[model samples]
Every structure is written in C-alpha cells, then in structure tokens.
Target: RMSTISSAINLPTIYALSTPPGQRSAIALIRVTGTQSKYIYHKLTGKEKNPVPRKAMYRNLYMPGSNILLDSTIVLYFKAPHSFTGEDIIELHCHGGRAVTSAILNSIQALNDMENGIDIRYAGPGEFSRRSFQNDKFDLTELESINQLIDSETELQRRCALSSFNGENKVMFQNWRQTLIENMAPLTAIVDFGEEIEIEGMESILNNIKRDVLKLKKEVQSFIERIEKSSILQNGIRISLLGKPNAGKSSLINSLTNNDVSIVSSIPGTTRDSIDAPIDINGYKVIITDTAGLREQSDDIIENLGIERAIEKSKRSDICLFVLEADSSMKIDESLNKLLLSKELQDKKVILVVNKEDLIINKDELRTMIHNLNNEMKNQYPILPISCLNQCGISDLIDLLTKEFKELSDTSDGADPIIMSQRVKDILINDVIFGLNSFIDCLDSDIDIVLATENLNLAIEGIGKITGQVVGIEEVLDVVFANFCVGK
Candidate 1:
C-alpha cells in the first residue's frame, strides 16, 4: 500500500513583503509561513538551535549558500499551530532600502533550490489571509471586515469595520444559530422517538418552538432594516448635479471637490458622461457626480445616452442639486418642471441651487424669482444661491448637504452591526428570510413537525454559511479575498 503524505508537510512555504512597496520606507516587513519557516530562519540568521518563539531578536541575515550579507534585521519567530496560518512563521523586519528588500527576497527563493523537500514561493494576493481563514484564524465575516478596515476612509466606515473585525457580530450570529439548533431539539425528539416514547407535553413544546422561531425571525427582519438604513455610511452619500446645459454644474462640482474634476467650457454638452468626484463633507464621505446637462431634446446619440444616464443617476442619488442660472430668463421650463415633480424624485431630496449669484445684481429680484418658481410648482423646494466663479456660498451649500446627511443617519441604529458585504445581505434576505418564512408557514393548524424542523434547519444553515461554520469554504474564498492586497 502506498503511504499518503500529510497535507501539512506537502503544503508549500509562502513568503512576501508585508509592507507597502515604495521607493524607500522606514522599515520593510517580510513574512514567511509554513513547514520550512524555521529552516529558512536558521539559514538567514546562522543559528544552530531554534530561537525562542514569539521573541524578537536582532540578527545578521545572510544568503543561503553564499556569505552575502542581506541585512542586519529584526526577526520574530512563531511556532507551528500557534501563529497565524497555524504554521511555523518568521517575520523579517528589514531596512526599507530597495536593494535590501530585494536581496532578502532573493535569498529566500534560493532556499527552495536546496534539497529540503519543502517548496518556498512568493505569496499571491490575499494568500496569507486565505491561509489564515483555512487555519481557523478568522471566519468569513471577520475576513470581509478585515478588508473593509483596510479600505475604510471615513469615521463611520472605520467604526463599522472594527465592530465586525472585533467579532461582536460573530458572537451574536453564533448565539442565534445556537438558539435555532436548541429549538430544533424538540422537533428532532418528535421525529426520532415520537412513536417509541409517548412524549408528553409535546403540544406545549411545539408551541414554544414556534414562538421562539417567530421571535428570531422578527429580530432578523428588524436587523436587516437597520443595515439597509445605515448602508449610506458604508457606501458614501451620493449627490447628483442636475440642470440645463451651461448652468454651471461643472463649475460647482469643481469647487466642491477643490479640484477641476469635470471639464468647464463655454460650450454646451461638453460633459458627455457622468464624472464622479469623491469628497469629504463634515467627516462623511460624499461622492458628488457631475452629470451631462439635461435638455428637452438632443440630436446627438451620445448626448442623448448621457442625458438618459444623468436622469438614472439622479434617481439613485441621495440628494439632487437642481442647478439653475441666476439670469432672469432662467425660469424652470415645462421639461424641468416635469422632472422636478416626477415620481422618480418623490422620495429624493432636491435643492434648487441657483448658480452664478454674482450676476444677480438685485438680491430682491433673485429672491422674488425663487419665490415665484416655488409657488408655480405648488411645492416649495429648498433653494440656495451660489457663485462658483467667485467661490461664494460654497460653505453654505456644504452646510445644507451636511444637514441632509444628518437626517439620513438618524434613521439607523448605531448599536446594530453595520453589514458592508452584499454577500451577507443576500444570504440573510434570500436564504435566511426564506427559511424563516417557510418555517412559520409550516406552523399552521396541521403543524407538519417534519417540514417546520427542516425549514428551521435551513435558517440555521444560512447563518452558518455567513460565518463559514457549516458550508464548504472554497466557494466563497475567491469573492471574499478578491479585494485584498498581496501579502495582506
């Protein structure tokens, strides 16, 4: 009989520069993990015996075969099944010079050339994190949160990612899964030994299980609602600029971002596509999109496509800035009025932004024009005057936007976990909810104990999939680690 090689021994040792690549850094961190980690450490440091685990030691690193000094570095050693990836690991804190990092990496590659029976190679993007997940160092939710934490740009985003990363939501989800499993006990008893043993109080037990399942379902539904409401915190607030051609939409966006993100020209229809400019408004991330000018009609095909895209973007945005020129002739025409009162904008907040306020010589006339426009529509939209050319009223515009976002933030509960992954959302809504609904439906007068129990198991499994508890981990690894940088 052929003997099989253990997977732990067969696995390749991986290495990568963990620190960000640059021309020069203060210090570069190169991490190595696997069966060959200790051997590589000994070769570099010229050590006869194993160094103390988890202890940092200053050592002179040399190439495997030659006397070439790679660098005098700080090396921290981690023993197997205790470190990240559950493997023997070594961290080389080397000088950040380009040549120093290069030499250290080359020396590690040379180790594979020797007859050690352990393969060593450069790690691919997210391989370290992937290995960590495989080693039970992190769950799916925690892995996704780690990525979010790395990519976080706002205070809210950082807080949300940190909450998940700290395993706050993980504990809650595990508790819910346990509750489902506990409740399944009654049904299993009935299904397995109902005939053999006359299980008394069976009706009462069934009633309690139904009540518990119902309560859990409601709690999950409410949690989903809060996550949906707070989604703006993760994905930034979207603001769309809408108006006729040459209404200073481009100039206003440029001023908001403090950079000329959109082309500003005297020519109409210069911006033939939507241009997004990310900005910070009162500590919250905001994406201000400068869209193609809206008109009643367009002859050019590209402009027509741009116009359609602009309308679609406005519908998706949290706020719409309806830019209007400050000129007396810049009245809201039939086409503009139709859009203002359209069903698409019924739920969206719109602010009538009168651009080129410097041209409005008569303040009274400008106020009168706004008052008449509001009255003509039979609905009063919040209006603000701005002069993009003179950089006037920009602060006031920002203040107004901040107020809008504040109202949005008030709808969600901060104590609840902020779910940033669409994968989790899909599992909860499509799978968990479906299972809960089916279980509840099965609890009618007839009360099919077997069906109800199966449905309840479905809900439990769905939650398991999220935490990577019950399902195969291979299917979701690709999506979960796709955004991760090389070397984690």
Candidate 2:
C-alpha cells in the first residue's frame, strides 16, 4: 500500500545520467522521472507534444520562463508505472561535454528551487534502486540483488549474487517459511482453540510439528552455513604461506601466476614482507600471499614493519599455508615451529605443504615423517608433496583451499542466513532472534499473550529490512545510505 503511494509520487522531477561519469561517448543522456517530470520537460522543451516512450525525437531544449536555447537534443518520455521508479521519466540526448551537462543541470536546479526544493539532488548512490523498492516495484531480496551485482568482483560472488537476485534465496526461503507456517497450524491450534485436549491427538500434533521443524531447520541451517563459509572465500579466500626462509615460497607464487611477482632466491629471508596476488581458484577468487619466511631477526625498521604486516595478514587470513622443504629432514627449529603450532593460529586453515619434491633425495622418508607428525598432532592436517619449480601439487592445494572455504558457509550447521553486515546480523541474532525465542514461549501460553504479538510486531521491524516490507512507512528517513564498494 505504501509502495502504491510512493509510486504515485511521480518522482515528478527526478533526474540522473543513464551512464557513468567521464565516459568518452559521442552523446550523453540525462534522465528525469516524476509527476513534475513533464513540467521540467515542457519548461525546457518549449513544445506541447513530446516523443513517445522508447522513440527518439529531435527537438531543441529550452530554458524555463525563457525562450533561450539550452541544447538541440533528442528526447524520449516514458509514461507512469511502466518505467523505472514507476513514474513519468524522460531522457535527453545531449552533447557529451561537462560544461553543457552542468549548465542544463544548474538551469533545472534554479527553476526547481523556485517552487520549493530542488526537484532532484544527485540521486544518492543506489537511490534509484532504493526508490524502486520504496515504490514496491521490487522486494528486499531484489534490493540486495542490486547490491550484490554491484559488489560482485569474482565468479563465486557473481554466482551468489546472480542466484539470489534471480530469486533463488527468496523462493527457497519463502517456500520453507510457508511450509513451516502450514505445519504450525496443527500444533498451534491446540493453544489457539483447544477445549480439553485429548492425549493421542496432542501427541500426533506435537510429533508432526517436531518433524516438520527439524526438516525445515536442517534446510535453513545448511543454506545459511554454505553462504557463510563461502561468503569470505567467495569474495576472495585469503591463503597465507608461512615457512622458514627459502622454502620455495616465492617460487610457488610465481609458478601459480606464471609471473615473477616475487623475487626467488636461495638466500635466507629473501622476502621480508608479504606479497599477494589474486588468482581464480576453483572458479572462486583466492588471494594467495607469500609471507616473509619466519625467522629470528631484529634490525631494520622497514623489514620489521613487513614482518608485522605478514603476521597480521596471517592472523586474519581464512587459511594458512605451512610450507616445509621436502629435502630438509632435520627437525623444525623448536621455537619458530612452536609459534606456528600454537593454539592461537592452529586448529583450522593450516596445512603442511612439503615443497621442492625435485630436490628431495628420499621422498619416502619425508612422507613417513610427515605422516607420523600428523598422527602425533591429531589434526586434519593434509601433507601435500610438491615441487614449486615444477608447479606440481599447486592445483591440489587450491582445490583444498576452495573446498574448505566453501564448507565455511555450512548452511547445514543451522546459522540463520550468514548475515554479512555486522549491524544487520547483530540486530537479527542479538536483538530480533532473541525476541523470537521469547515469543515462542507465548505460543504455548494461555494469557492475553500481548507480549508475543508485540515480539512478532518487533520482528517485523528487522525482517522488514530483509524483505524491505516497512522501508518508508513505519520507519522515518532513518536509512543511512551506504557507500560500500566492491572488492574491498
């Protein structure tokens, strides 16, 4: 209903350039939408008749309250409710000069200000899309779609955005929700309209509800899990390669990218800082980093900063690559190895990569030793033997990283959607979901249960964000717009 009203607003005087700024195009288009759109149009057009929607007609654009020429242009008008923003919108073909565009915009601004407020301010980033949601032409899921599309920089994120934008998440979630609601009827009726409940009937209803909830819960959990696990890795899985100096760390990076991005040398501490490159892994973006080889050292300021950055990067990375030379049968240096094995960085996202297979004299011994080490550690540590010079086993390494990152989304684990936004997720889990938990108690109670209704009402406030159900109605203009950029 609110959507219908906002749609009725006629943006009557909305304007935005259809193309991004600074493009070297032969012509530029400035578009306008709203009820006053025709007013803006006629003021400049100086003619009563206009070109039909989708058709370009040549005409001279005029200044308001004056016959002065602004530009000789082609104009097209789209009637209400059928165009973007669901309002009467117009497009003008004008010369692609900054001065000309600004002149026309300034003239329109002056005319619009005479009435009350400027007809349009620079359409705030994503304002057009937001207005579409306000007008009810699109839903919350679709709103996120525009965001996802804008944010997508790789195959995995693209698929995620595309899938959800195409209504994969919406259809799946809504269907499951509807099924839960349908199954809830039998159990809920006991409280809603029950006389003296019979034991067998009550048991059957409880059993049915339990079964349905468990089934739906499993689906929801897995969906959320998969998205969560894959979200970080999907955007770009951070893989940190850690090792003592000259464990072929630089060689591995160069081999993967097939470029000499990092200097490869047999010298100890060849790389003091972490070097990173983005490569597609299993069709997902994996940001692989070659960190400074771990060593006991303290001297140069620049080198110290590099080591510090490497440590910080490793700490935040989704996965760590523990690189060990296959030729080195000597035990790992105690202190340095202990730091790597500590609980702080251990338990997950760490792997034992045995490098320099071509230089290994006894591959059999290294394999047995690595196997024994794994047994003693009792971790899910994978020992992969490879020669960085030969580029062997790198694909397997990437494949393993991709699998682990994808599993992080663990939708089967039953987390509510992998709410990415800290603000949104916190509101849902800490605020809204907690409220839902309390409201569940009301479902089985016999009191007026106004609290339950209230909780349900409050849940609408949060869920409304997901579905955009209450965007501009119950809410004031409290929506602080975001400037979230892609590949951050």
Candidate 3:
C-alpha cells in the first residue's frame, strides 16, 4: 500500500513488484508503466513486436550486454488510456524468485536515460489507486471499497467491502446525489415564484419541492443508518463489562480471551481497574474490557478512581455487560440491583451475563433464576450463561458477540462503502449541511441558478474526496512524501 503513494512523484516510468515479496511460485510479474515501455521491450527482445495493447505475447528475454538468456515470459501490453495506469504498460510473467525478479528490475532501470529518457522508478504505496483515480478508472467510493476489502476482519465486513467494490453503495449514492441536484431545480424555482413572477408551474413546483424535501430527508436517514453499520464493521465495536465486586468479570474476560490477562484471585479487589485486550472473534475485532467492580466502599483512592473509570467506560461503550455470579442466586440483590437499575444504565444496551455456571447444581434451575432476575429490569437484557473456569459456554459467548457485531454492521455481502475515516465524515458534514443546505437557504435571494449549481458541484467534490473520487493529485503526492519512510 505504501508503494502506491510514492508514485505521485513526477517520474515518467514506474515499476513495482506486482506480486508480494518472499514467495516462490510458478510465475511472478514484473510490471512497468510509462510511455517508454515499448522501447524496452524492443531493445531486449530484438523485435519491434509492439505486443498489441491488452494482448499477451510469448517472448524470450535477453540481457543486451552479454546476449545471455534471462527467461521466457508472456509479455502483456496495455496501450495508453486503456490500461490500469492509463499509460503504455508492460508486464512480464517470469519465474518467481528473488534473484530473477531483482535482475529484471535492474535491467529495466539500466536503460533509464536512453532513447525514451524515461526515469524508471518504483511505485509508492497506494500510487496505483492514486493513478487510477487520476484517470477516472474508479471513483473515490471504489477506492475505499478496495481498501476495506483488504482490511476486512469478519465475513460481514468482507461482504460489505466486496459489495462496495462491486459499486453497490456508490451507484446508490451517486443516483441519489444526482437526483438531489435535479430535484433542487424546481425547489429553487418554487422559492423564486412571487407575485411579480407569476410562474406557470408555481403550484406544481411548490408541491414537488415539498415532496423532494421529504425524499431527501429519508435519504439522509438511510445514509446515517448505513454509516452507523459501516463504522462498527470497519473499526470493531467496544463491549465493556461492569458489575459489583467479584461478579466473575475477570474470570469471564480470561475465558473470552483464552488467557489470564487480568488478575483473577479469589480476593474481592484483586482487579482494581479497567483491563482491556483486543481479540479477534469470528473475524471481527472485539476489545473486551474487564472493569473494576462498581461499588461505594473502597479505602484506596486509586481503587475508587478505577471504579469511577469503570462506570465511565460503561457509559461510553457500544455494548454494556452486567455480570453476576450464578451462586449468588437472588432474583435481585436489592442493594446492587437498585444501583444497576438506576436511571443511568437503564435503556442502554446491556447484556446480563451469569458467570460461574460450572458451580451450579442444575443448568435449568440456574437459567430460570437468571431469566427471572432479568424480567425485573426496566429494559430486557440478553441472558448469557457461561463459566470462565473449565471454559464452559465460551463458544456460546463468542457466538453471541458475533451475532451482536453482525447486527451492528447490518452487513450482507461483500461491497458496502463506508465513511471509515473522520476526515471523510467531517468533509461530508461540512460540505452537505453547511454548504449545500446553506445554498438551499439562499433560494429567496438574488443568487442565480448557476450559483446553486456551483454549490452542488462543491458538495460533489467534498463527497468525491470522502470516497477518493476526485482526489487532488498534489494531495496524493504530498501525503506520500510526508509519510515516506527511509529507503522507500
């Protein structure tokens, strides 16, 4: 990915390892892109074979200096404006080996200052996508979809990325954004209708404006829901565990993580703070937290602070988990239940987890008790039965978490475009709400329809940037240089 960024420089010829390094295979590709590609092919092969664009040619490679045979390769060619880089591109399918690939690259660079004056350089991270963006090969949304596909952790995420890559989301948004522009026409005309104007379709335009406004609002609602789903899938959701002291929170954490990351002694206050670790469950990142037991009695100031932090984490969490020991069998431990059932945690997404299930005499009786206890809550919570020790019901817990993420992501199949970065979100909100909405606000003014169109274009550009649609070539170059590592 980093290699793509480096190609934004003003180099004429670009080349890179089309396949990743450190691999042995039947074949590997050495790809080159530039106007001078044909010259190199001619110089080495001693044939003006031109290798018709988009055609594959079987050819023997030879080092001009020694007339020594290099290897047999299928020379693939793509003519300008039709290729991946929108330039004359050459690709060699040669044997996969470090020495062979290196030799080929060195040979390509050797004829640098020759007839074509092409400076053969390696591609930067993300430069291929960047170049494609430059040539309108793929829109900003498609670029992000590719990125997401590479980053997908879960089945659902992979599905969304594939869907977006296939342009399921981009087509939806483009159709909508374009429709919004068209719909705005009559709305502005409706607002312009006055006694002096006496427009013929005044009534019709006003009705259309109202109808379109409602439609636009519905689109916004749909977009927000989609964004919410994409966010969870891309970033992974945060689930926090909170309860009174010795609620088996640490034990559950250890079980879920399959490791003793937290202190789990019989001591009531063994874990004095929030302990968090990332674990991949069902291809989704779950940052599970084992927080200090929320309670009032604490002599140590740090422990008290930890308790406060636990409560805060619960409030900030995507899912709140309230754990209880199965042996502490009361339907409601009036003291702690009152505190938990208090206004703050109520109505939040809380899961009632019954830990220490291995110690229970009868599974049915324990389930009934936990169910009955949960029935008294202001809101219904999921009753999950698990035993951290002996690893009982851990798979069930993981299943529960996967289902939760699937619900959060609303993921179907590959290809869902997401506003994954805050930079994108900010660009969108600032342009749409402030810029486009403000344009609507100016309908009654003397501003011309052309000015409204201008605003629409601005909104489009901002949206384009969000999806990597119409990225500034210079911006791509700047970022590449800024993030450049030594020996890049």
TM-score of predicted structure 2? 0.69
> Residue 393 error for model 1, in Å?
2.6
Candidate lDDT (C-alpha), each? 0.77, 0.58, 0.63
Candidate 3 per-residue lDDT, tens place, 1-488, comes to 22233333355677777776658778888877776778878866767656787777888888755577778889988887788767677888988988777777777777777354566667776666556656667665676567667655556567767766787667766765676667666645544663466678655664564466456646755676677677865665678776556666667766765632222222233233335434556666566554433233221222234445555666666777767677744555444454455565664466777787888888788878877877766456677787788777778777777676666666544434354444545665777544566455544465445565466556666555555544464663344333322112
Best model per TM-score:
1
Candidate 1 residue pairs in backbone clash: none
Q: Tell me, what's the RMSD of every candidate?
A: 5.9, 7.3, 7.6
Report the lDDT of model 1 for residue 215. 89
TM-score of every model? 0.81, 0.69, 0.71
lDDT of 1 by residue, 270-339 (tens): 2333355355666566766544333322223222334455567778898988778898876766666666
- Kindly provide the TM-score of model 3 when superposed on the true structure, using C-alpha atoms: 0.71
Q: After superposition, how far is residue 293 of candidate 2 from its true place, in Å?
A: 8.8
lDDT of 2 by residue, 21-119 (tens): 556667878877666777777778877765577677788887777888888888888887777666777778888777667667766666676357445
Residue 141's lDDT within candidate 3 is 64
Clashes of each: 0, 21, 30
> Which ten-residue region of model 2 has the weakest summed lDDT?
294-303
Best by lDDT: 1
